[model samples]
Target: MTRIPHETSGEPNPLRALGLDTLRRRTSMKWRTYPEDVLPLWVAEMDVPLAEPVVRAVTDALALGDTGYPAGTAYAEALADFAGKRWGWAGLAVERTAIVPDVMLGAVEMIKLVTGPGDAVVVNTPVYPPFFEFVTHMDRQVAQAPLGPDLRIDPGTLEESFRRAVADGRRAAFLLCSPHNPTGTVHTAEELSTVARLAERYGVRVVADEIHAPLVLDGADFVPYLSVPGGESGLSLMSASKAWNLAGLKAALAIAGPAAGADLARLPEEVSHGPSHLGVIAHSAALRDGNAWLDALLAGLDDNRSLLSDLLAEYLPGIVHRPGEATYLAWLDCRALGLGDDPAQVFLHRGRVALNSGLPFGTGGAGHVRLNLATAPEVLTEAVRRMAAVLE
Candidate 1:
């Protein structure tokens, strides 16, 4: 294991300074998508440097000419160790794990293993847009269940959707987004247990997208769906991509709960062949050796979340901003700002601040925009300054 420097081991701001001059040189879609004047904050990509262990792991692999095919259980075992240490999830059996190209793709494959085309899949709207796209691509019908007024999953609405999806007596599935995207709500243990019970009652299989499990902020507990009671029959898609700023590397793990082992075992061998060999190496090293660096990044994000709240209050006071308990996304209600249903369009054209338009997030998305909060405090301040100028 690589040793972290004493100076940075507990530095409050361990993440490197993310200045605009340094960031604009990158070619990632988030940086290169808009004109030079536009400050891009739409994508989930972080504006931080690579963790030392991840860099060393990738470099060492290249130096030894060890890059070949993805194999072995090192990655799974590493995640198991991390989960046990960080989240207290002791039941993550490595034997039931598999590597996939990415989270959404793994979800498609998992959905296929449990259901066939034309089967309905229940999902919360104002969700990650890919949820809708992937379900359509799988030839599966999506049963939309909008989150209630509080933007948290409502039991009544969920039960209603589950009832509808299984109404024809066909086996349907539920796609759960934990620490939900766009809004960033860390679904509580009780909520997850309720979902499990409902799924069990209706005989529906559950697939949890838990990629953000490690990014729970401010001491908020992130309850992995499979860790709660009644989650034994479900499957989870987890990855180091979001937490470690490795989206470009492309690797994720698919874990099957105890009761779902038989169905997961039937997944085709071809499924494991496509994951990037280097992705596995880097992600494995991240899970095993990047805890110190991750802790530092999380600290920076905690500060940024508060910084965004202050900036919003000072500049765009009309926009309703709620500090999320997890992840670095702020779901801003811009309806009061009179930016119309798609505030992102107005912000892009007038303020040159690129944001994710909320229209595609489904029912609750209108008059809202999802802001990425995993950047430098100054960048967030500048983003709001530009957005406020749109009104001027």
Candidate 2:
């Protein structure tokens, strides 16, 4: 990891001197109405403005009054180009790519399509709650594979779990989160390869959620699952929504490889005749031209992440983190703090900060909370200060 240069004296972070301060100043004027003096560090959204490309795309779409369904070939070329430039892998075969409303919808659809009722779907515990929600909601049996202390999938244990499920005739699919949410640990290419092997061995399909791929900070590279060796056999779901703050627009691209691709390729022919015109346009612009703004945004996030790490080390010692590799979400172990009951509630009602309780993340997430550091450094600093005051 590269260390950012700090000033010799009371070094001021460049992000603070940049647009972050301005953003906070405007947000503070109406923040109280939303959370009442509390920082909203719960959701996976940045407080920064959108990239110019994204803005221009949306604006142009509105200007042209092109509200109809998008043509198939338009965003396909953009996605293919983005994938090639970003990951150095290509041959996306746009014919197999389908636009979905969002990641959650894609996940649900994949689960239903891959497995049937009574079959088991494997997912690591302390994951993005929706992983569990999708399986259970579909009335399918869920196989919980808890992540180990490093907050990563334990291969040995995972292998055993898969064996048990297969023995029971319940094994069918695995729901995987890459650059995993909450914890923010980007899985190594080797790690993804192992997962592919597991899927091959157990005859289970893998559903990789890579929604947070673009949020990787400070020159950190994001690896697409399909880019990994033998990844062409797995399913990769990706989008520009998370990092580009296009969630409201509701668009995600699902790439199907030989193993899972063959199954998903029928999506366009079977359902949702075409992609959303607005989503396609916005996604195309962001991927094709958003690099400059993305670089600056990542720099700002790095500063905020560094400030939070320093503050946690100094003021809230003993709380542990896994060293975030991607995304603004920070998974913190607050068991040492011993804030009774849901820590999120305690912070909101008392500390006046809103954080996502770790409980929903699964077993290991019990004593933790997910913090979103996408806001300005000033807001995060104030939130930490208030938290310290409560604990002190």
By lDDT, who's the top model here? 1
lDDT of 2 by residue, 148-244 (tens): 8888889987777677667866658788888888788888878888887887798787888988887776555677787677677667778888777
Model 2, residue 334: distance off in Å is 0.3
Whole-model lDDT, model 2: 0.75
lDDT of every model, 2 decimals? 0.89, 0.75
lDDT of 1 by residue, 149-242 (tens): 7889999999999999998978899999998997889898899999999999998899999999888875578888888899999999999999
TM-score for all models, in order of appearance: 0.96, 0.89
How does model 1 fare in lDDT? Answer: 0.89
Measured by TM-score, the strongest candidate is 1
RMSD of 2: 4.6
* Model 2 pairs in collision: 126-361, 126-362, 256-261, 257-261
